[model samples]
Target: MDILHIVGQQRLEGTVSISGSKQSAIPCLAAALLTDQTVVLEGVPEIGDVATMIEILETLGAVVTRQGDMVTIDPSRVESMPLTGAETRKLRGSIYLMSVLAARFKQGVVGLPGGYAIGPRPIDLHIKALERLGVSVRNEQGVHYMRVDRLVGNRIYLDLPSFGATISALLVAVFAEGTTVIENAAYDPEVIDVSTMLTNMGASVKGAGTDEIRIKGVSQLSGCRHTLIPDRMEAGTFLTMGAALGRVTVDNVIPLHLESVIQKLERYGALIEATDDSVTATFQEAKPVDIRVFHYGGFPSDLQPVISAALLQAKGASIVVDKLYPQRFRHVQELRRLNARITHEDASIIIRGGETLLGTEIEAPDPRGGAALVLAGLLASGETTLHHAEVLDQSYERFDQKLKELGALVWRETI
Candidate 1:
């Protein structure tokens, strides 16, 4: 395993360029399977989950070539095969393939998805939406087998606006025989990016970044080139890091995507300036504030952990409510190791700040949790050792490198 060692209380100063959206790029890779032509994707993040997705693509017979942040996927030579359950277990993004494969090959098998074990992200919504689209889905043991004789578009309502389910529905409905309407769809920028990619590929998709999505299905989809948007979560992470350390100017970011985070951070007394494509955050002091994580246009649940780290030095009491993932407070125990005063009740985490954090060895339960640990280390008084820190690769590429660029003393040590 690899451990990350950080010498805390160091001021961070420099401009860091945000990478492309890992969330958006994963679905785009799966959507490439919807066509038989060559699809070129630019601005794809070089993250571990993406590499795993590319491996899944190649395993299923797609000719994939990568250079820097660009990936060319040739699906003309693709073949229908049961995706390896073990491989699918490596990434929760692999569930995006269920809809693509069912639409393309009429039948496929995928195992229970895995990624950050933040909470139980059940695929019931995905299954329900797919069943509404005339697909027969069954779970045998832990694997899901889905088949469709012919997909007929219909209105599908989601119980909640799940980003994964919305993207999965779009993938499945892109090539259906008629129109498909998705109500209470995810209003995430990533969803809009996928919709835009499908539109560029000649699919009629509208109402992305809104609660309701309308998709006029087509008989076929052609390949096209699309550039991914910058990752807002990564931008938020850096911003939170800035709140704990010193100043961080994030480049290559779409300011609009960071509206919720910027609003919250500013409310908590962090100095933030946003331009068209960049955001600069300078921390003065941490202020206690209550945060509620919601769907898009709200504080992202993905950013809950990092922000929690930022709240460690808050003046008073702070409460974090994560409705999306109730068990997202996995970092609480690890942060406690750094002497953070935090407690939880159900889905809410209460943080009492004003404690001087002393660094100690801790473990990262997941990617976001790992990031929170790193942030805690940034504010702590001594050396912090984070175990299982390599999990950051799942979403972030060159995270340690980026932090080092910002003047943080971070290094990877294999143990």
Candidate 2:
């Protein structure tokens, strides 16, 4: 097993580059399955989720090649392979491939959605959207079997603005017979990113990053080269690290995409300077603040764990609430193991500031939990050993290495 040995009380300085968006890359790769040409993607981060998507594509007969940050996916020789239960069960993103396969081959069999158990992410919305697009969806055991001869586009009103359901709607609607309208859609930037790529590939998409989206089906889509947006989630984590422990300049990021996180950091007495492409943060005496996570354009639930970890040094009490993931207090438990004063109440995490955290052996429950544990380690004075650190590779690209580049004392060990 892989573990992280972090020597605490060491401040970080210098610059760190953010990687590509994992959110955009997954749907874009699924879009590639709609075409027969070679779809080239630039700035695709090398993460475990992406690697799993690539492996899934290859199993379905897509030719994939990777050179650094560029990925070339050729679906010219694609076939309808029975996506085994063990295969699609690797990650929740694998669920998107089900619609892509059904759209291409008229039928598909994929296992149920699986991945980080951060919250209740039911796939009922995905199935509902697919069925609305004229696809007959059935569940036998834990696998979903979808078959559709012709996808008839229609109006889809989602109960909630789910990111996965929005992507699935776009996937099935692109090759549909007529126009498809998605109301109460996800307003995330990744939705716009996927829409832009689909438009470049000869599909008609409009009103992305809004409550409503319109998609006009095309006869066929050709492959096109697309560039991914920066990973704001990764950028936010690094920014929290800088404001909590040391000074760090995070580069290769989109400032507007991080407005929510930046505002919170600045309110916490961190000196923040953001340009068009980078943000530099300097830590000072912290001021406690309440953090509430909502949908896009609001504080992201994904950053709740890491930001809560940073609030430990504040002078007073801080409340971190993630309504989207009520059980996201796994990091709070791990931080308590290191002698931090924190409590979880339903969807809220109450953090008592000014606690001297001591380093000890801990484990990460998930990817973002791993980031929070690492941040807690930075506040500790001794050696902090973090097991199951491999979960960090799921979303973050060279995270510990980036911290090391910014002068953090960290080492990766196999024990």
Candidate 3:
């Protein structure tokens, strides 16, 4: 494993280009399994999660080749083998293979998904949605086995607006025989991105970016070239860092996807300006603000910890709450090591601002939690040794390189 070596109190200012959306890229990668023709994906971020997905694709005998950020996947020789081993457990998106495999092969076997131990994600929705589509699903020990005598389209009403469930239903429904309607679907931009790509691949999908989605089943899908949407999480990270440090400009970001975060940062005392594809953040005196995480069109739950950490220097107290994952306060203890006054009360993290953070060695709990530690490290007094920081690469593409580009004194070394 590698650790991030950071010299604190060095301002990271300048422009940083946001990479491809990790949320969008993975599903689009999984969608390739539905076709035998070649699928070319541009702007795919070079991140750990994407790498793991590509590795799984290769393990299934998909001929995958890469050139810079562009990935060409030919599933012509792919097999619906049982998904197991370290690769499956390394990424939570491994379960996404279930839909495409079930659609194309009528049977699929996969191990349970793995990701940050923040909280229990409702994967039952995925199984339930598949079952509603006339698929037989059962779990033996931990591995899931799914099979269908015949593919038939059916209506699926998600209990929650889960992004995974909506996309899973869409993937399987595309190959079914009849029309399928999804109610209370997730409204994330990634859902729209996946639908866009699936449409390009000759699938008929409608109302992707809404609570209700209608999918007319097609006999087969062909591959096409699709460019992924810009990553909003990575874009929000730059804005958070800029608010904590100095002026920063994040390019290649879609302002509409980050509307809630942009508004919140403005309230928390960061001078923000946005054009079509760029957002510039300038440091201002920190101010206390309350943030509540909701689904898309709301404050992103993924950035809860990072934003909480950035607000540590605010003039007053601030509250960061996540209804989606209350246990996300795992970073609270790590932040306290740097003299941060924070309290975890159930679903909320109360941050007491105005305390000078002292640099020291710290361990990251998860990806976003690690991001919180990174911001705290940059704000600390001296050098901060960040251990177990490799988890940050799971979502952040070339993190240390991007920081160095922005003039931050940061580097990575093997532990």
What TM-scores do the predictions have? 0.98, 0.98, 0.99
Deviating ranges (above 4 Å) for candidate 2:
none
Residue 122 of candidate 2: its Cα lDDT? Answer: 89
Candidate 2: Cα lDDT at 196 = 95
Q: How close is candidate 3 to the true structure, as a TM-score?
A: 0.99
For model 2, residues 1-415, the per-residue Cα lDDT tens digits are 7999999999989899889999999889988999999999999999999999999999989999999999999899999888875657868899898889878778998888788878888889989999999899989998788899789889999999999999999998998999999999998999999999999999999999899999999888999999999999999999999999889998999899999999999999899999989998899868998999998898998899999989998979999988898877788888998998998888998899888989999999999999999999988889899999999999999988898999889999887
RMSD per prediction, one decimal? Answer: 1.0, 0.9, 0.9
lDDT (tens digit, per residue) of candidate 1 on 52-160 = 9999999899999999999999999787788765779989999999999898888998888887777789999999999888889989988888889989899999999
| lDDT-based ranking | 3, 1, 2
Q: Model 2's lDDT to the true fold?
A: 0.91
- Model 3: residues >4 Å from true position, as ranges? none
**Tens-digit per-residue lDDT, 85-171, candidate 3:** 789888888888999899999998999988888877868999999988988899998899999898888889999999999999999
Positional deviation of residue 220's Cα in model 2 after best superposition, in angstroms: 0.5
Model 2 residue 298 CA deviation in Å: 0.9
Q: Which runs of model 1 end up more than 4 angstroms from their true locations? A: none
